[model samples]
Target: MQNALKELILQMADDALVLGHRNSEWTGIGPMLEEDLAFSSMAQDKIGHALALYTILHEHMGEPDPDKLGFMRKEEEYRCCQFVELPIGEYDFTLARHFLYDHAELIRYEMLVNCPFEPLAQMARKVRGELKYHVLHADTFLRELARGTEESKARMQAAIRYAWPYALGMFEITDADAQLAAAGAYAGEKERRSRWLSTVSSIINDAGLQVPEPDEAKAIYGGRKGYHSEYLKPLLDEMTEVVRLDPTAEW
Candidate 1:
């Protein structure tokens, strides 16, 4: 009913779409068999969530196809955080991304579950139910990796370092976040971000890992503004090419 809601919905839709594609990159390349399955399944869930969100956006926008919105959007038009577009690092890195994202989704969706908008709140509740399992799966793996062999520990630490800045990208404090909260589409971002950082920092400390200082003034930016890394375009081209091949073709 409002442009604010439209933009807010699209931001979530696009974030899930791109992040799902990024997660999908590890379909067969994970360090272990268990990890391969875990990452692949996580990617599936992210993509599934993206589909649901995009379907909502499509209906609201009077669009016909969800695939077009996910696949056909130009790079600069995408609203996915830069964190999702970065190349997949080792299994450790993969876990880092998963651990941060799943927990953040849990918090974000928990807030959204009570949104003023009934349809969006319903979707948030549905996705939050699924994210419960996703977060656990990631959390278990992160703990094991932290307590595993020396090599595993080193790699996990390195992954955490690599993933730290990107993790911050998850909190895109833009007009969209404000608008959504103002419209009752979501709880405010400020509170959510603080809770997320504290939650994540505790996990890091428990893992015997070090978390560097947090200076919001020094944080990296761009995903919210649509400037992504080199990884996004190629990923999207492969992801969307088949759909774009014949836009009228029915599944």
Candidate 2:
């Protein structure tokens, strides 16, 4: 039970940490100044959330302190889904990924708000509150872009299609998922995926976009098992550079 819970927490924390850095990449380069500030703000929120979850692990699960657990892990030891590890490509693709991911995240935390694990449930309540803003930002961009010129609609559609499979990969079930669900620690990935699909499909259709057929979009899994694309190791190297430079420095 404890191991399953630990796995669940690690996966969530790793996902937040990696995606936070990816979002931070847009701090100065976003196409517009408002968007630039928005992504930067969201990036801070994500990293803060990661730190909170890592602290939970340290407090309850006997893991190392948040700093060590976050920066010292090898690429293969990080449990973030491969979807978040991919380079933030064009703006359309990034927005599409954000739309897909934040909705799923909101749903996952919503499910956990009343979970049996008091520590996690307490955190989930706080996370769900913050996630609402993320979903709103993603949804607004998706709709506005899809309703723009023909080229904008076409690009948004293409980006959504391209992101669909990888988005599904976000819910890849782990070995511990079943145990987590059975023990009331979590509701499991399948349930979250189901709710996410329904929730996002409605928004996508209303925005004049097509949600790709699930059968045709084969999820790009394996990340839950510590398997990742070539992108992750490089990302980790960059993220941990400061820590490596001066491990003894106090935060």
Q: Please report, in order, the local distance difference test score of every candidate based on alpha carbons.
A: 0.78, 0.91
Q: How many residue pairs clash in each candidate?
A: 0, 0
Model number with the top lDDT: 2
List CA RMSD, all candidates. 1.8, 1.1
How well does candidate 1 match the true structure in TM-score terms?
0.92
Compute the lDDT for candidate 2. Answer: 0.91
Span of ten consecutive residues with least summed lDDT in model 1:
212-221
Model 1 stretches astray by more than 4 angstroms: none
Q: Candidate 2: where is the Cα deviation over 4 Å?
A: none
Please write out the lDDT profile of model 2 over residues 1-251, one tens digit for every residue.
Answer: 98888888898999999999999999889999999999999999999999999999999989999999999987789999999998999899889989999998899899899988899999999989999999999999999999999999999999999988888899998888999888877889999999999999999999998989976249999788899988999999998888798889875
Poorest stretch of ten by lDDT in candidate 2: 214-223
How would you encode candidate 1's per-residue C-alpha lDDT over 141-230 as one tens digit per residue? 788878989998888888877777777777767776677766667766577778888988888888887775666764556777788878
In terms of TM-score, the best-performing candidate is 2
What is the lDDT, from 0 to 100, of the residue 147 in candidate 2? 98
